[model samples]
Target: MDAAALTLHDMTAADVDEVAAIESRVQSFPWTRKNFADGLAAGYRGWVVRRMGAMLGFALVMDAPDMAHLLVIGVRPDAQRQGVGERLLRRCIDHCRQAGLPALTLEVRPSNERAIAFYRRHGFAQVGLRRGYYPATQGREDAWIMTLALAADAA
Candidate 1:
């Protein structure tokens, strides 16, 4: 897909249902519709990606005192590996930089090697681990905490 063909817009209340639906389809442990609504209500920075008026993905970020936290970033299953995620992530990084944040942080399932590789390729690094950070079909799962520091001279 051509990256230039995509459009991104700030997330709003009207987009909660569709964003949650996409989240449910893409994530095993998806955020509920209420979760998306509440995040928007709380003034989290969120965005929706569309192509030719079709929803392709969404991302939500929370601001911390010193950094931004990526709460969710999901791409439609059909859009995976097609650069939608990369564009969305670049937007997140840009947003953080515009906010003067020093870094961006997120936690991913340790089992999600593909996501880990994606983050690494985008300059994120494994910073720590959180025990029992997520529920699993069998038991709780560990989370890999990853961070991307935005240095003045860094990309």
Candidate 2:
């Protein structure tokens, strides 16, 4: 399906099950349902991408005073490469820009080349690396910290 057919909207508590399912299918170490609940409780910006009444993906963003962080983003495995991820990312970026944030940051597992490439394509630059940032099958793995500066005219 085309990404244009999907609608992006704020996620609700009822979406936890579907969102967790997508998260689990897309990642080796997925966030638990409790994680989503905690994010909601903390008033994070959590969004969902849906089409034909079915969820395609979701994203969670946490905003600080001067900066915003993409806490998590995932698309259902079957929806990969359909532009849903980009749409979700664009929404988060717009939110940060509208909030007058200086930048948006995220950490990606170094092994996730696809996500690294995607973020780089969307103007994120490698700022640093975190040692043992993500759990791995054998051991902990490092993550690349990336940031995208919000343009004055952004959003």
Candidate 3:
């Protein structure tokens, strides 16, 4: 689907169930509902991407003075490779830019090649790795730390 066809809106408390369901389906080790709830309660910037009333994906971003961190991002299994993830990511990037954040960062499972490629395509580069950062059925998984610097002129 065309990325332009999707609309992104700030996530509200009412969207927790739908967002959690999609998150669970998209990841083997999804965040619990409480995680999202607490993030919202803590004033993190959360957004949902939708098309024709259907939720395509969601993203959660935590803002700091110097940088913004993407705490979580997910696209429905059926919606993978459809540009929904990019739309959600762009929304976060825009938010950081508007908030005057100099950089944005996120961690992804080292084994998730598709996600790694996606972030790379969006100008994020692998800057580090976190050993055993994610839980997995076998045990734990490492994560690649990716970062993007937003240019002031670009915004």
C-alpha RMSD by candidate, in order: 1.1, 1.0, 1.3
Sort the predicted structures by lDDT, highest score first. Answer: 1, 2, 3
> What TM-score does model 1 achieve against the real structure?
0.97
Q: Which candidate number maximizes lDDT?
A: 1
Tens-digit lDDT track for model 1 on 1-155? Answer: 99899999999998998899999998889999999999999999999999998899999999998999999999999999988899889999999988889999999998999999999999899999999999999889999999999966354
Model 2 lDDT tens row, 44-93: 99899999999999999999998999999999888889989999999999
Alpha-carbon TM-score of each model against the true structure: 0.97, 0.96, 0.95
Q: In candidate 3, which residue pairs clash? A: none
User: What count of clashes does model 1 give?
Assistant: 0
What are the Cα lDDT values of the candidates?
A: 0.93, 0.92, 0.91
Q: Which of the numbered candidates is closest to the native, going by highest TM-score?
A: 1
